[model samples]
Target: MRSAITLEPVVVTAPMQTSPLRVVLDPKRPYQPVPASDGADFLKSIPGFDTIRKGGSNGDPVFRGMVGSRLNILVDGGQIGGGCPSRMDPPTAYIAPELFDKVTLIKGPETVTWGPGNSAGTVLFDRTFTRYEKPSWSFIGSLLGGTRGRFDQTADIRAGTPDFYMGVSANHTRADDYEDGSGHRVHSSYERWNTDVTLGWTPGKDTRVELTAGRGNGHAAYAFSGMDGVQFLRQSLALHFVQENLSETFTKLDVRAYYNSVDHVMDNYTLRRPDPDSAMPMAMASEPARQTRGGRVAGTFDWGDAVELVAGIDGSGNTHTSRSGGPEGSIMGYYRDMPRRRDATISTVGGFSQLTWYLNTHQRLIGGTRVDWAHVRGYALTGDGDSGSLSMGSGMGMGGSAPETTAASRSATLPSGFLRYEHDLADTHATLYAGIGHVERFPDYWEMFGGHVASTVTSFQSLRPERTTQLDVGVQYQTQRTQAWVSAYAGVVNDYILIHYLDGNGAASNVNARIMGGEAGVVRAIGSHWKGNATVAYAWGQNQTEHRPLPQLPPLDVKLGLVYDAGRWSAGALWRVDSAQHRIAIGEGNIVGDDLGPTGGFGVFSVNGSMRLSQEFTLSAGVDNLFDKTYAESVNAISKELQGYTGAIRINEPGRTFWAKLEVKL
Candidate 1:
C-alpha cells in the first residue's frame, strides 16, 4: 500500500511581487489570479517591459525601445527562436512559464557573462532541483477556466531520495477569440501544450549531474496578419554538472551543454480560410526551422573573504533552413514536394571573467570583460533551391530572381566590458550603484538574410555590425515597512538595424540611434492588513541618422495597486495608466514589427480575490478590464486597414474578463 500525505497550503502573494522593481520573477507563483497565455504576456508585470501584440498569444517582448537580437533570451542556458521571417512564432511562444522555477532579467549592456550581442538585455528561465534527505514524492496541479472559453491545465510531479531524483511537468492551454468592449471579436485564438522531464544523480558528497529534455507544440490564429502560425514545434536537451566546495581557493566548478530546435509552419489556409481578393489570392504556406547547440565551462574562485571571481568560456552554433509550397489553390503535397534549403549559419565562441571586490562591509566594486569571435555565412542556390533567396527576399520584390550560386562568410572579433561601484548607507538602509558598458553586436540572420535592401543588393552582406555604449545608475531602499527602487540607462547605438515597412512590404537597413529609459517602484505596508504599491516607466529614442524621433518607442506608463489581507483571505485592486505618444517616424522599426503611427493612451482597472480552502487546496479568481474600457496597445504596428478591416482602427483589447483557478498540492 502507498502512503498519502497532505501538503501545506500555498500563500497567495501580490501578483507582481517577485523582487519589487527588478525584472526577475518567481515562475512558481500565480500571476494575475490566472495563468498568462505565453511568456510575453507575463512580462508585462515588469516595469519598462512591453510586448508587440498581434493577438492573444505569442507577442514579441520589447525592452525599453529595442527589439530583435538586441535582447538575449535563454531557456536553461540555451538559445531558441522561431523560424518565421515575420516572427509569427516568437521564442516566448514555446515557454510554459509555470514549468520553470526562476526567471532572471539583466537590463542593458551591463554584463557579458551570458552570450554575445544583447545590447537591450538578457532574460534567463531556469529550473533547479533539490536533494531530499529521505525518499519522498510530491505533486502540484492547477486548473483554470475563464471568459471566452479559455482553459488551462498544468501538473508537476517529482519523486526523489538522497542520491537520485526525477521529475516531470506537463501543460495544456487553449482559448477562443475574445470580444472587445464594443462586442467585436478580435480574431485571437490559440491552443498549445508542453511536456518536460528531468533526472538527477548525486554521485558524491559534493558533486551532482542532471539531464533535462522537453518538447512543446502549438498553433495560433492572428488578427493582424494574412497568415497564422499553423505549427510551432520545439525540442530541447541539456546536461549540467557541478562540483561545489572543491577546495578553499577553488570554491566551485560548473559545466553544461545544450541543444534546442524549433520547427515552425505559417500558412494562409490552416487557421483561417484564404482571402481570395487579398495579397496572394491563393492558398500559400511556408515551413521554416532552426537548430542551435552550445556548451559552457566555468569556475568560481575565492580569494580570502573580500574577493571573488567567476570565469568561463562558451560557444554556440546555429543553422537555419526552410521550404515553401502550395502557392495556388492546392494544399496537398506541400511538405512532401518541398525540399528543405539551408539559408544561414552562425557560430560564436567567447571567454569572460567577472570579479566582485568588497571594499568593506558597506561598499563594493564589480567589473567584467569579454572577447568573442563570430562567423556568419549565407548560401545562394539556383533553380528550385532558390526558395532560400526567394522566400527570404519576397517582401522586397526580388524573390523571383536568384544571383549566381555563391557562398559568403564574414568573421569579426568583438569585445565587451562593464564596471560598477556600489555603496550602502547603513543608517538609512539604502544602496546606490552606477556603471558604464559597451557591446558590439554581430548582425543576426533576420537582419542579414530576411529582406533585401534593393533589387541591386543581394543579401545584407555590406551591413556593418552594431555597437552600443551605455551608462546605468540605480538606487534601492528597504526597511521593515517599505521598499523602493529606481534604475535608469542612456545609450548611443552605431549602425542599429532598422526595418522599414512600406505599403505592406518591408526591407531591413542600418542606421544610428540614441536611446534612454528608466523604471521606478515603491511599496509600503499601510497597516497590519493593508498594503499599497506604485510603479512607473518611460522611454525615449531618436533616429540620429535621420534627425527625427525614433519609431516604436513606448510612452510613459504607470501602475497602482492596493491590497487587504486577513488571515487566510486576501483581496486586491490594480489600476494601469498610459500617456499618449506623439513622437513618431512613420516607417522604421525592428524585425518583428514596424511603427505604424502615434498612439493615444488609456487606463484600465482590475480586481482579484483568493482564499485558502485547506492545507492542500486553494481557490483564486479575478476580473480584468473591470470597466470594459476599449483601448489598443502602444507597441503594435498592425492597423485595422492592414488586416483588411474598415477604417484605421487598431486592434482593441479584450473586454471585462472573468477568470478562476483551482490549485492542489500533495
Candidate 2:
C-alpha cells in the first residue's frame, strides 16, 4: 500500500520484538487520556475501540469487528487468562498504564511472537528500562476529582545508573454512583490499586536484561448487570533481554518470559441482588472462587532491514470451586476447588517471519507468514452435570467427539499471511500504500463447552475452530494546508462462531455466522497550536444462511477531538457519538446471550490537560463523560439484572467519572 507521504517522515515503528502499531503521546492529543485505569478502558479512546457495558466494571473491549478470545492480549509478552471467566475484571482490569512505557496494537491476525489464535489481532503493553549515565533518581505524581465523587492518584519513582536500573509505581481510583444527563442514578463505585517493580542490567553496549513483578486488587458495582464485584486479585512476573545492532545482518534480538495469575471472588447478596427472599439460594457471599495461572517465553531476531522472525511457547491452567456460605455469601454450596489439571492447561508453540524489501527506495514491498501449533487439554470436575465427552466441530462440518474422560486431547495448527506495497513520489512530499491479510484462529474454551452441546459430532466436536480471509487498504495525504488518512476494509468470515442464549439459565449454544465492517480516521492540523482528530467506523454481521444480523456487532460510531499545545502545557476536548442500533436479536440467543433489542444512540464529551513540572517530571488529568451521560454499551448474559439475589454479580459501566496521572524521568 502507498500512503501519501507526510512532510515529516515519522520513524516511530516499534522494535522487531514487540511490533505494536506505534501510538504517539502528544500531550495535546484530544480523546487520548493518560494511562487508563485498565487496558480496555484506555482502548475506549481509540477510534474503533468500544466496551460492552454491564455496569460499573467488566466491560469487554471490541476492536475492528472482534471481541473476547478472538483478540490476544499480552503483558510484557506473557499471554494470561482474563480474571473474570464471566469477565468481571476483564483482562485489561489487571493492568496499570503507569507501569508501561509503550502500548502497541497489531490489527489483524497476530504474528508468532504473541502465541496464536488472535483473529482480531494482538495488543502489546510494555515498560522500558531507560539507562542513566550516572546514578540518578526521579519521581512523578497525579491527583484528580470531578462530578461524581471521582478521585484518583498515581506515583512513580525511578533510579538508575549506566549499568543498572530500578523502578516502581502505584495507582488508585474511585468514583461514587454517577448521575446521568437525565438525572438518573447509575450504579458506579470502583476503586483499585497496583504496584510494580522492575530491575535491569546492561552488561554491554548492546545487551540488556530486566526483571519485573506486580500485584493488584479492586471491585466495582455494575450499572448494566445485576452483580457487584466483591473482590479481585492480580499477580505477575516478567523477565526480558535485548541485544541491538548485533551485526550488519541482524538488527536486534529480543527474548522474554513471564507469568500471571488471577484470583477472583464474587457474591450476589453483597451488592444488591434483586431477590433477597431466597432463603436456601442465598450464598454465603463467598461461595465461589476461581483462579487461573500461566506463563510464556519468546525470542525475536531482526535481520538488518529486510526480515524479522519471532518464536514462542506458552502454557496455562484454570481451576474453580465454590463453598456453601463460604467466603462471601454467593450461593449455598461448599466445594473447595477440585484438583484441577486439565481446565488449567493450554500449551502452545509458534513461529513467524516478516520481510521488507526496498524495491528501489522509491518503491517497496512487504510480505510475511506465521504458523502456530497449540495443544489444549483440560478437565473440569463438573460432577453429575451430564458430563459426557468432547466434540471437535459439532455445529459445523469441521471434526469431533471424544469421551469426557480425564484425558482429552485437541491440537490445531493456525496459519496467517500478509502482503503490502508502497510508492514514493519525488514530485511532492507524499507516498501511497496498501495491503491485504488472511488469518485463521482456533476456537476458545468459552466457545467450546460454555454454551452449546451436541450429541454425536467430530473428534472433540465442541472445540471446532473457525477461519477468516480479509482485505484492508488505506490512503494518507499531507499538504501544507491539510493532513489526513483514510483506511477501509471488507472481509468474509467463514464458520464465524457465535453463542446463542435461550434464557436466564445460561443454556447457550454455538452457531457459525459471518461479519463485515469499515473504519476511518483523519487528523487536520489547521495551524500552529490548533489540531483535530476525527474518526468514524461501522461494523455489520449476518448469518447469511440463517438471514439474520450477527449477535453483538457494535453500533456505528464516530469520534472528534480538538487540541492545543505549547512547550510545557497542553489541553484538549473530545466528543464521541454512536448511531442507535435497531437491529438486535432478542430471541433465543446463545453464547453471548441476549442481543437485548435496540441500544439507544448516545454522545459523550471529555476534557483533559497536562503541564510539565520540570525537566524530568510531568502532570496530567482528565474528566470523562463531562456531562454525566448515562447509557448501556452492549448486553451479555453476565450483565443479567441482579435485583433479587442480594449478592455479588456481574453488571455494566458506571456513570461520569474523573482521572489524573503523573510521570517522571531520571
**Model 2: residues >4 Å from true position, as ranges?**
1-35, 224-226, 272-274, 277-280, 284-344, 381-407, 425-431, 451-460, 478-482, 505-512, 564-571, 588-593, 607-623, 626-628, 634-638, 642-666
Q: In candidate 2, what are the lDDT values of residues 175-290, reduced to their tens digit?
A: 66655455656566677788898999987768888998888888877654434666667787877888877776555677766667776555555565444443213333332333
lDDT, candidate 1, 85-167, per-residue tens = 66777788889988888888888887778888988888898887877788999998989899999999999999988899999
Per-prediction TM-score to the true structure, in the order listed: 0.93, 0.82
How high is the CA lDDT of each candidate model? 0.78, 0.58
Question: Worst lDDT window (10 residues) for model 1?
Answer: 389-398
Error of 1 at 149 (Å): 1.1
- Evaluated at residue 258, the lDDT of candidate 1 is 95
The number of the candidate with the highest lDDT is: 1
In TM-score terms, candidate 1 sits at 0.93
